[model samples]
Target: MRKGLPILLALMMASTAVGARAESIGHADLARLNETVGAIGRRLADTDARKSDASALLTGRLAGIGAKGQWQVPTFDTLAGKPTLHTIPVDFMLAQLRLQTGGKFAPNAHKAIANGAAPALFIRGGVMSLDELAKLAATQHPGAIEQRGQSFIAHWPIVIWSDAGLVLSAGQQLELSTGEGAFVLNSGLFTIDRASLSSTPEKNAILPEFRPFLATAMTGAVQAREARFSNLGYGETGVTSGLSIVGAALYPAKMRSSFSDSSFVGLNAVSLENARDIAIVGNRFQKMVGPAIAMSGVTNSQILGNVMMGTRMAQAIDVQNRTSDIEITGNVVLNNRGSGIFIANDARDVTIEANLLSGNGRGGVSVVRSACIDISDNVIVSNAQVGIKIRASDALSLSGNDLIANAGAGISVLDQQKGALISVADNAFSANKSGLYGGAASEVALNANDFAGQSPILLDGEFAAYVPELLRMSSSPEGAPQAFTIHPNAKSTTGQTSRPDCKTGS
Candidate 1:
């Protein structure tokens, strides 16, 4: 008897499945759908109904509950330009949009509205909903113009433009216009990491800029007025690096507290470590505590055409630790307390060219433990230390430089550096200590220079001094102190006993 019951239950289940599948929408069903739609249109509408209400009819037809407990939503393909007034409900419309366009409401809006009747809205059964009719109306209606009064309001986690409305995400071609009007973002704080919004004169598109703040961690600073803690991150480690505050200009006095308040002047430490293809150009870095650009363990970096000035305590450009193939050119560095440019700690294949450095307290340029560095066409002036310093380096070349007013040697090489082997040609040195100094270096070549300083430039250490005759300085008048003696009171005497030769192997 139990086996018989099992067989009967299986037969009954099969019959139910077949009946459900075989059931089809009937002509009566269609008639009822039409009637329900008409009734919906008349319910909330006045007798002198505007033509816009026709959208309700469309919503009702698409909102029918099927026999299988499934709901059907209308799509553009289903409408096919039929002219009956269809009122799409809001729920159906939002659902349709969410389904069809993947949350992009702008693209398909016009077509959806034009092809349907007046869209409808309802509040029933403890639920607020939109009929297909309302969807059609809203889609067809012109988008609201951005209102000026409500441009920036606090909207937790973000301060959005009142005019921009509710946007899940902005498209690539996003451009915000604050023309003749002011827009303020005052969300207490907001983030713009990797989201671009540019309204400058250059381009007119949404999201013109790619990375306003391209990082994960942020605190204060966006609209932090009178706030104590404010910071941004720009480290490549994907952890907190506190460098997104690099180029942001701020005033310390305006902040709420003076705990660690400082104004933004230049780039903080940028983590280009082990990263490749870095290019820094056309930036104005002023009064920064860190290097204008710091790259280490990186490859194929190009730092060019930047203005670095008034740094607090570091070099303008600091490259270190096995970096290679870097090109630094056409930059202006001024008034740094440290080196204008420094390449040290095993960097190789670096090219420093066409830079203008002046008023540096320390060495204008310094390269240590580096190889294949080409220094050319630079104007170094008024630095307290040597114009260029090379140590523990190899295959270095210096040419076409104007080293002026340096307190130390025009170009100094030490510790077996290949500076002497490099092509030192067509360089001009005026009022420098020693035009060129070499120590223990091999294979140096000095050719076609314009050395204008004290006569008989000194070379120290075990160097095979080539072109020592060419190292002669420009003429000085009777008592001009022969290249402005290191101490103003002292003078260079002519006698052999007075002249102590401080050459490498004297």
Candidate 2:
């Protein structure tokens, strides 16, 4: 009996260590951090940095060669041979630090992934209900599942551990039983199809730490279709990854992820970082606290057929960090506190077309430090700032767009003297405070643009118009709305129609 007891203990240890070795985003960083902490002890360690303050540290970055910011680690993605400059997230660093100092570090994702849902709940997935899943898991891990009629509750905070896949779908209701309850995807497939993840009683109302959220990491893939996330996320670290997918950009492009026909209500924006080949379509974003969709280092993806409304203090769509080859089209972004679309950080080869951008607090589209961007065939109206503001960019072509009645200039090209290439043609501008600002008229080649029957409306009004000091005129530019045509059926989610005649709509 004594010999058998040792054998039993060995089996238990093996089970606990099943996925001890896995791939994680910051496992190597965590190792190096430990070494630094040991050697340096207190010196040079940002001791005040905590897991809760991750988002605040994201702002510390500098551009150009040989400029050191606060970051100590090299970035995962490289540009042409130069290492990308970015700060290691403070909260993420703090998350690992706490684990090491007092607890255990989060293990890397398990190497082998099962084909379907969580192995404990699903033998082989063909779509099962929560009741069946809880029953099956109860036999192995007792008290893990609690039931209340149609809703099932998890005994603890849900972590789809490195080796696991969780597919919650088919009218299932998995309530976040605790305020700190969350669903973390670590190198696995997390699918929420026709299912819901919600803290119905609103845990945030009581314990602020009870923020329920969904975060994916370590090359994890998310497939959410017709799913709903409510009362789920906060803007701080440890819980900030609200409906987020932070993938490795250099990872195989064939590994596709998608979020379509879903709904995010009263949550932090959907964030995608270092992700590739994703499709975000037919989603409804409502009353988000910040940018409805925040993307960084993402490539070869499409943001289409989505309706983003009532974003607070940020653009509806914010793309940054050299994210190239993306298409932001067929989306209705309006009434946001910031710009409609904001792009920056040398991001290139983007198409912003067939979108209805109106009533934004900032520019309809703002591009900075990006290149090879095309903005066309959209209604940019009633925006608080310029319809399209370009700075420190190259190869920007703005054609086939209607810029009307904006509080600021229709087009503001701030860096044309700095060798930025902007070619504007076949666009209609009406009632803009300034048609064009900055850029020299001599620098533009106007042979391609027809300058027939044009009206000079660049702040030449008697009632004191609002215009920037500088103006860039294109050989008495043409108001040729006829040259451009949009799809006849283009309409926003609120059923607001986009004008196909290239004319201003009431």
Candidate 3:
């Protein structure tokens, strides 16, 4: 201060001289302005120092925890029924569990521990019981937490009473050994990876019905990968109202009943009813008694990149009961007892694309009483019945597909009701019994398709009127046999033969 006083005095004199030349200005205002600027500079410097200290503290804490090679549990004095705020790392709480339980944790707990580092959580702490803390830890981490020696064996169902979260991390396993199913009463989120859930088989006369591994009536997301479900009756996984099931694997019992029971027929691998905004992606469904994936009254959903095989008595994927706006893409459906993909019961606005459907007992794709469907870019072959079958459907577009070696027609249209419009374009058909079969009342637009090695475009009943148009739109390679062949009984409504020479008739 003493050294700067002379310069400050000179500056003040200069300001006074300037003020005299101008209107009468005071020196006190200049002094106050200088002081305020100095104060602000000091405050900013302090703030930066504080921020540096905070950063150092966080770095040191993380380093210290790593150096210890074991978690250090924080000590907290209990305040019953009093709410307290805590800013703590989730690992600290997990460490506390290890301390309380003497390091004896379940396999799933260990999996939760290894999935990833725990996040620092700011929680409103209260009188949290151990159970509540376990659940919190499980939710914050990515694995399930189980109490020590808690047997899942029970005759009645295991019901989650309130809002909850369960997770099973990679390399973790959880088997629910129950005669009955598990249920979630309230909303929940379940994340599972590489886990198994199953039921113990009951003796004769005590067979369980509708005993799925996990069933929920609440709204949530079930995100699983490499998860397994087996030995459960009805469906292995089920959701009644709301949920998205993504990336799961489901298998039936090793030895299941063969009585052809209806309860077992309609429900098996995965069941969804009255669900919306759902997505089933990248799952494997194998050897199930009923449909691998069954939905009713569902809408606005996507089923993508899944594989379903060896279905016992139902379609690989079944959509029924007015489900609408569904997109099924890039799936492989093979060796099912019924149709590879079944769309029925007024389902509308559906798209099936880029799929491989083969070796199914029924048609590769079956549409019954549905409307506004688009099927494209699929390889449908070696099915016991037609490659693609449409019955009582309207506004169908079948394009850019490969239909080959099916036991029945490449494309079969039957019982086409009024107002139906079928469009066939850019498809390659080979070695099927018949390339296209049209039944009564079928109005077809055939365009730019390749037909080879079989009878192509067979029309029955009222469909004969479209023969000239179908012939004009279809073609075969040069030096190959003529592609279009008409049945002897085929007659146009204008009383003309089914010939290319015939004129187009209404």
> Any runs in candidate 1 off by more than 4 Å, and if so which?
1-241, 244-267, 417-420, 453-506
Q: What is the lDDT of candidate 1?
A: 0.42
Q: In angstroms, give how far residue 338 of model 1 lies from its true place.
A: 1.1
Tens-digit lDDT track for model 1 on 173-252? 12232121111121011222212222213321332221112111111122111111112222222111223211111211
TM-score of each: 0.45, 0.63, 0.58
Number of backbone collisions per candidate: 39, 3, 2
- Residue 175, model 2: lDDT of 68
Q: Model 1, 470: alpha-carbon shift in Å? A: 3.6
Q: Which candidate order results from sorting by lDDT in descending order?
A: 2, 3, 1
Which pairs in model 3 have colliding backbones? 143-167, 144-167
Q: Alpha carbon lDDT of residue 132, candidate 2?
A: 55
- Of the two candidates 1 and 3, the one with more favorable TM-score, higher being better, is 3
Compare the candidates by TM-score and give the number of the best one: 2
The number of the candidate with the highest lDDT is: 2
After TM-score superposition, the amount by which residue 182's alpha carbon in candidate 2 deviates from its true location, in angstroms, is 3.4
Question: Residue by residue across 1-506, what tens digits does model 2's lDDT show?
Answer: 10111223222222221111111112254344234323321221232221112222222110110121122121111112211111122234326423432332232111111111222222221223355556765666565467776677764334443334566767877765433233343344566777877754644324454455566665456677777777666653222535676654333322367777677776777887777878887677777877888888788888876667778768899989878889987666667899999999978888998676777899899998887888876667668999898887766677667676678877777644333346555555555665556542112211122211112343222211222211122212344111211111122111122211211212
Candidate 3 stretches greater than 4 Å from native:
1-156, 180-186, 208-210, 235-267, 456-469, 472-506
